[model samples]
Target: MKKRLLALCATFFVAFSVPAFAQGTVISIEPGDGVQEALQEALILAEPGSVIELAAGRYDFTGPLSLDIANITVRGAGMNETVLSFTNQTTGSEGLLITAGGARIESLAVEDTPGDGIKAKGVDTVTFKDVRVEWTRGPHAENGAYGLYPVESKNVLIDGCVVKGASDAGIYVGQSQQIIVRNSRAELNVAGIEIENSYFADVYDNVATHNTGGILVFDLPNLPQMGGHSVKVFRNTVVANDTPNFAPPGNVVATVPMGTGIMIMANREVEVFENDLSDNASTNILLVAYPRDYNDPTYNPLPRAVYVHDNKHGRAGFAPDKAVKDIIAPITGLPVPQVVWDGAVDGFWSAFFGPDAEDAIYIREPMGTTFANLQMVKDMILPWGASPDFDIDDYDGSVPSREPVSLPQDQ
Candidate 1:
């Protein structure tokens, strides 16, 4: 009797503990399969490392589809085919709120939420691929917060997503690291794509057009971690975004007459390169105030260590002679020759000023000091040369197309 009792206890322990050691299981959800039933079954039976596959249909959650399961993969038919929508979400409610790490929601469309479309909080290894998120609530305050808001998340990849009509921001990834946003389009929103308080991010080959502000990298204040540093915002096409009533209020930066293209604020060790920026209402790119309170615990300074090169912008608001003066010197408060190419200064002097008068700009530092790199000045600001767009050997048809360049990666 004693031996039998001991054996029974061991059997019970094995039966319970075996499930814990096993990997998560896969659960499938289909229209014909009863959506709520499958979801319920998954919630009940799913372990860690589970996958929940959904068929093509519109799923309206009577309540939130909150997944307590960790390391689960949710796959859908496609963005167009499968739709997960919420009509009535109260404050701070998301269409899909992912709290678990290593979770993925791919190839679906989520819309019409009270708060954010998808909010991934404190999760790691999250990926949203080919997903579409929109705030159908018009442009009012009732509109949802962000298309994708990943705060304090890591290794997040938001690729090929069409984010539209968010009252706040289309793609807002804040306080995250190793984030990659590629080939995404953000339109008809307050701010297009915002990567703030992030590091080691690569935002490439995206189109942020016709938003209030297009393609913003900011290290905003009033945050615990306040450095938007070591980012590569390259090869994006930003244009004609500054239609009024869409831009944010109380913004000190005005849209350039042509609209604002790329606005970099208080970020450090950043590189902005090989982008097509034009038709902004005010300026193509604005280097706004950096976060002044990051350096010391009390008072961090704005981002330093910035490199801007080989970008192509329309000549609507920017003139040949004043290109460097207006764009570079004003922000740096440095001399003329410090920013522009050597050829550009020589060419500007030749066309606008005689030899004696041309030399005067160098000596007097009208703004503050002489310009740098006369050749680049000639190439950039000088008139009647090959158009900056077409002159480059790898210039591909005024717009970004399939044609490759020598340094395709550089652009």
Candidate 2:
């Protein structure tokens, strides 16, 4: 009887110990049949601070995956090793939609989504690291809109990510504050890395190449968040962005001219410095006003207090395209200036009152770096031929440097 009881106790101990060991803080998920269901279930049922470990394998998902739980991590073995393929996805928009705060998604590849890849919306303290979102078909109009998209989120950090073949913008952060996007590569997209309608952003150390437009800082009208200001774009390599715009009609990025290096529109207090801009056929840098008509009284259509300094420009503006080819290059001549700014200001009232001292375009560059201010508003009102201003000395002052954006995740 004693021996039998001891044996039973040993069996009980073994049975419970195996389960306890398996049910630890980390939830390991293997890729196989029913992977979608298993991942979705794990995302839904995971407790706070739980780590959902995705093993190194290809996961074939037929629908979108969402995580609504806060303070959970979804980590894969490696970006290239662990693949999440949504090629045949028939439901939902994004490949993965994260709606919860304190979410960290790292080391995974999302491929061939019809809509977007890995979108974090309305969350706080989100981090996307070492992830790759790619459309293997190359740049096409039917490709997804954005890759590594974080919108309406605060304290966002996107680091060491690669996004390719997006129809719209790759590595897009919209309506987010306190954002830092660094060490990323965006290629074969309409706009490589765009900071749209966001405040207090630092975009640096990224490679923006082979896209239609390399980097765009734009503030459009009629968004939940407006008044984009205090953005610093520095230390980026924006080069050879000569891809034709493949964005579908009626998209905002469709208006971006091909071969644009860095375009800024309708934002205030922006600083562009220490970038390597080379081989962009349209222009190295373009500063323009909002081209469309809008009824938003709260919106300011003119870019103000912009500072562009200390950038290395090479072989740009040789072959302009789109509206720049049709209108701007004709006035500014072939091989349009490396820096092109449409001299647009508030209104007719500004002709007499003059622009405020704070709302000025400042450029401090090397001696031979070319520039042109198209005087667009003046020509529209006066119409006495296209009198483009090629003198860079008129705009030679600096604005106060903005403080670097600090995110909680970087710490």
Candidate 3:
């Protein structure tokens, strides 16, 4: 009888404990003022694939919170109920930095960091959901550079988040591939959302308002990543980006005109469609060539293979900025067409007769929206001036439509 009882107890222990062990570890952090310290220790001690649960409370963190483990999840009670305030942050470039791939950070609010609010670097299969990163002090030049910054990462999904008050861009995705930034809202920043030097990005169903510039798809020079391409911006509300440019002087976004919406600069295979652009003073939508000098030989200065169609615009291009007020408006006059391009290209040969001689800017604006191509000949002379081409029919050629971004192993 004793042997039978011991055997039964052994069987029960194996049945329950084995399954519990296979379910992975759960590190529950107690609610306390030393939340940062406790969380840091948990990160250091927790095994891979562990779930770190943060209780509902305000966690004041001074330094940065980092995750270097793969397949780890840092989840909070809720974005509003559990707060990570960095208002008095003394050290770190970001509120939370995740370097490990296959990690998920969700349901947390990170506020008032000195630099970027949440930055994930070189990570694959990372998901950021229900996260709110904001600057409580409002828009200023000293605000963080980006609210949710992801660079050089692949298979990234940023969903259902709200970000505000970035000196540069509220949601900046750079050099990343297979990125989907959807169901998000950004406001009161320099560039509400920017996809720079990235490929295969799908940005849709987002609200971008009250920013310096609404949405930007740019390819800048001199970086580890160059030549952004294959971007799709659709079904988003990019409106009234009238906030003053608070970006630091040396940054690329500083040159972005205020009250501009959906600026695409020097990228290829871009499609902008089914979006609502309204009340932007400078221009509702701009497709311009990169004017700055670049050292990168592989970088394409002119935007090629871009398709813009079926977008709705409202009352844009009313008040112009300094660049427009000084150069474009002097020749084109006020309400500088809803869509304008510098028409700067590779000499008259390409502009008139070359492989890309066809107007690269394809505008099928169904609302009978007029557009202007400066054509780099204002006052009939060359160099700085341009004769404006205000006919919408001239830019009628269409490029091949690109496929949507495809990623493997997505959640």
Worst 10 residues of 3 by lDDT: 8-17
Worst ten in a row by lDDT for model 2: 8-17
Instruction: State TM-scores per candidate.
Output: 0.67, 0.93, 0.90
Q: Write the per-residue lDDT of candidate 2 for residues 82-176, one digit (tens) a residue.
A: 99999989998999999999898989999999999999999999999999999989999999999989999999999999999999999999998
* Every candidate's lDDT: 0.60, 0.89, 0.82
Candidate 2: C-alpha lDDT: 0.89
lDDT of 3 at 332: 77
lDDT agreement of model 3 with the native? 0.82
Which regions of candidate 2 fall more than 4 Å away from where they truly are?
1-24, 349-354, 383-386
lDDT of 1 by residue, 185-254 (tens): 9886677888888877888899987776678788766676677777778889887665443434443222
* Cα error, candidate 3, residue 378 (Å): 9.0
Question: Which candidate number maximizes TM-score?
Answer: 2
Ranking under TM-score, best-scoring first?
A: 2, 3, 1
Query: Which structure among the candidates has the greatest lDDT?
Result: 2
